[model samples]
Target: MQRIEFRKVIDLSHIISPDIPLWPGDPPVTFDEVASPEKDGYYLRRFAMGEHSATHMNAPNSFHPNAIGIDAYEPASLVRPAVVIDLRIQARDNPDYVIGIQDIEKWEQAHGRIDQGSVVLFYTGWQTLWDDPRRFINADDKGPHFPGIGAATTTFLLEQRRIAGVGIDTHGADPGQDTVYATNSQILANEGIVLECLTNLDQLPAKGTTLVIGVLRLKKGSGSPVSVMAFVP
Candidate 1:
């Protein structure tokens, strides 16, 4: 038997606060101070936010009727081999960039085939602009602008590769400007899982890592905030 060892753990989730930019029209987050150690014996806080706020996971139910919710998947299915696809340069030049088939092909060529049940993360370096909501959303009269996976690439991963999940360090897996959400629908139709608003992906290697995703087991919830960690040996 091969012994598995975790040499390092890296956080891939963004800290959620009032400053965290949410999807337009989504409810704002609230953190209430219920008690303090100095006065109420122990510190306590009550908080609430949109289920999709911060680093979060989206189940197929987000789009497909009768599809599984965030709690339906077994814990084992959520832990899988992870591969990071770096496209920071392209995203730097064009914030509206969309990861295409060529990007996947090139990554596979340099590394190896993306094995089935693998978790693939797109590193567009968008986390760098997280400090400012305006820049992060990149919204204006023309709507928001940010790099994301295109419909074709998303379809290939879900249909062809049969990946366990996909993730990105943006508002969502699809471009903010894609009001129609065609790509998102395709993924959901294929029963795909998505982790959005990830951060610190640049710290991971191309492959040979395991992603430990922490998702709230909300009952019949479409999605929920998640905390993702990478175990690298």
Candidate 2:
């Protein structure tokens, strides 16, 4: 007989709860102890929240009028090879920077080509400020400033790179200062999936890994909160 040993578990899910915080306008997630042994016969907890809070997925229906719901999304699509492209330097210098083709090119120059049908994650190191509302939102007299993909960059990935989806360590895949929501619109229109509010990307390697994302099966759901994990092999 042979004994088996597992390496390490890389938790990709962001902590969730009413106190986890959310995008300024989105409803806060809430949980209540509906049943307790001291108060009731058993112990149980009821939960309530918006589907789009915390680490979550954006279904095609999010922006398209006649697109498939979150429930219809194929399970195979949720699990795929993943790579992290570090953009902390760019994000630190330009809070409102939109990840572009040049960034992708630079990443490829360092870490081989991005494979087709792979999940491309942008690591901006923004999750460090998750506890501070001011820093998390980067709200100023002008407005919230954050890093994300631009319209052109997203279109390029969808059309040229043919990636499975895009993930980001930010509230949304689009920059907070975006007036038109260009990136989101493009992705949804192109039937592209998006994983948002991701954390702990810094803990994973740059390449040679797979990601497992479990999204709630909400009928006709535009999106749903997900438990994401990364496995290095």
Highest lDDT scorer: 1
Clashes of 2: 0
Choose the strongest candidate by TM-score: 1
Candidate 1's displacement at residue 121, Å, is 0.5
Q: How displaced is residue 94 in candidate 1, in Å?
A: 0.9
Which digits, one per residue and each the tens of the lDDT, describe model 2 over residues 1-233?
62323265577778886777577677767788889899888999888878788789888888888888899978877778888999999999999988999999998999998899888999998888777756888877777889999889988888888888889988879998887877777777766678988889998888877888898999999899998888876
lDDT of 1 by residue, 1-233 (tens): 63446899999998989889787778899999999999989999999999888889887888888988888878877778899999999999999998999999999999988999898899999988888877888888888899888888988888788887788999989887777776778866766668888999989999988987878999888898988889987
Error of 1 at 153 (Å): 0.9
Ten residues in sequence with the least summed lDDT for candidate 2: 1-10
Q: All candidates: CA RMSD in angstroms?
A: 1.6, 3.1
- Candidate 2 at residue 109, lDDT? 97
